[model samples]
Target chain A: ELQKQFKQQEEHAGSLQASMNTTQEEITQLRHKHTMVKAAIQEAKWKQANLTRRVLKLVSAQEIERKRGVPLDQTEEQ
Target chain B: LMRQAAHVNAWDQLLQQGHDQVQQLRLTLNNVKTDQSRLQAELDFIQGQQQELEQLIEPLEAAAASTTPAQHQG
Candidate 1:
């Protein structure tokens, strides 16, 4: 009887190990995916910054001209 | 009979240790699950932010394209 119970316990341990392995696999995949998403976010933010810089260049130039006595309405290029 | 009793007691102790091992494994699993949940939420939030950032950039890109040739900023 004791031997049978020990055998059962061994089987239970095996089952639990399998489950733990599966969960570990899922965690690995999720971490991999999270890394990719973070990289993509970084790329997007960099693009946004570059675009903002380009647009600001034109606006700041016009501002400098207006401060040097050019009228705002006249600064509008047709 | 005495030897059988001793053997049985030994097996019982081993079985109890097995149960304890199982309990520890389960707790570790629960912790992994919690970690998974937190990571998933973080991923979802960052993805949402990425979408919002992309949307905000669209008009800026259009304006930039129309402004002039890409000027290299020093």
Candidate 2:
């Protein structure tokens, strides 16, 4: 009876160890995915900043042309 | 009998540690998944904003390009 108990305990430990290994591997993959998502976010933010700058420049140019007495319709027609 | 008890205690300890590690790893995975989704949402927002900004700029750019050559010629 003692031997059987010991064998069962050992099997339980083995199963737990296997579960831990699988969980650790999953964590590693999750970390990789997190890193990749973070990088993509960074790239998206950079693109957003560039587009914002372009929009500002264009808006400011239009403002300056308006101030210089250029008709908006004339510019649009050309 | 004492030796067998000691062996059982050791196995129990090992099993408990494994369970704890697995639990902790699962929590970490959940947090990472949440973060991934949040970042994805933010990226999507920025891309949407970029599209809007580009749309706003398109006509301005065309107008600027159209005017510049006329100004130069005049």
Candidate 3:
């Protein structure tokens, strides 16, 4: 009877340890996913910033072109 | 028997804790997706606005170019 009880306890302990290991793995996966998501967000933000800068530059170039009364390409036919 | 029961309870508690963390992670991921989509929409809007402004500038530029030589001559 005592031996049976010891065996049952050992089995329970082993199963619990397995579950803990699985949970740890899940946690690690979640952390990795979060890191990837953060990196993507940062990349999107950088792209948006670059687009905004380009738009501003284009606007400024158009203004300068207007003041000079020149065509956008500024290569007149000879 | 009692020790086995105690281990089962501890295992249950740990599983519940893990479930809660997963739920929180899901919520955070959802929020991040929402923010990313919103920013993307805003970027699209700004791009469209820039195109329209450039289009409007074209006619004005043409008008300015057409009159420039005449104004210089006068």
Candidate 4:
């Protein structure tokens, strides 16, 4: 009976150890994924800023073109 | 039995530590998501402001165009 209990405890401890190892691996993977996602979000923000600048530049160019008395289609042709 | 008790105690401690690490990771993930959302909102706001500014400039641009040719021809 004592031997049986020892066997059971050993099996239980082994299972717990395996569970701990898997959980640790998963946590590490999740952390890596999180880092990647954070970087992507930052890159997207930079792209957004770049897009805003382009829009402003286009608007400024439009204003200049309007002042030049160029029709819209003619401006595009040029 | 004594050795088994010691093993069980150590295993339990390991489990507790693992749980704490998972909790910390979850918190960090939540923080990253929140930051992404806030930046997205700010981007939307900036786009809206840019549209408004562009709209305001349109009529002014037209008026300037109309006035300039008259000044040249006068």
Measured by DockQ, the strongest candidate is 2
lDDT tens readout by residue for model 1, B1-74: 99878977886786687677667656766765676686567667656766665666666567567544634431
List per-candidate RMSD values in Å. 6.9, 4.6, 9.3, 8.4
lDDT of 3: 0.63
Clashing pairs in 4: none
Docking class of 2: medium
Estimate, for each residue in B7-69, the C-alpha lDDT of model 3 and write its tens digit: 766765765676576567657666765766676566667657656766766676576567656
2 or 3, greater by lDDT: 2
lDDT of 3 at A26: 60
Could you give candidate 4's per-residue lDDT for residues A1-78 as a string of tens digits? 977986897688678668766866776787688677767767766766776677678677767866675676587898
Q: Which window of 10 residues has the lowest lDDT sum in candidate 3 chain B?
A: B14-23
**Candidate that beats the other on DockQ, 1 or 3, i.e. the better one:** 1
- TM per candidate comes to 0.52, 0.77, 0.46, 0.52
lDDT tens digits, residue span A1-76, model 3: 5566457656756765576676567657666766766666576667667656755765675576577655523665
In model 4, which regions exceed 4 Å deviation? A70-78, B1-74
lDDT of 1 at A6: 66
Worst 10 residues of 1 chain B by lDDT: B65-74
User: Model 3: which docking level applies?
Assistant: incorrect
Clashing pairs in 1: none
Candidate 4 clash figure, as a count: 0
Docking class of 4: incorrect
Instruction: Please tell me which model should have the higher DockQ, number 1 or number 4.
Output: 4
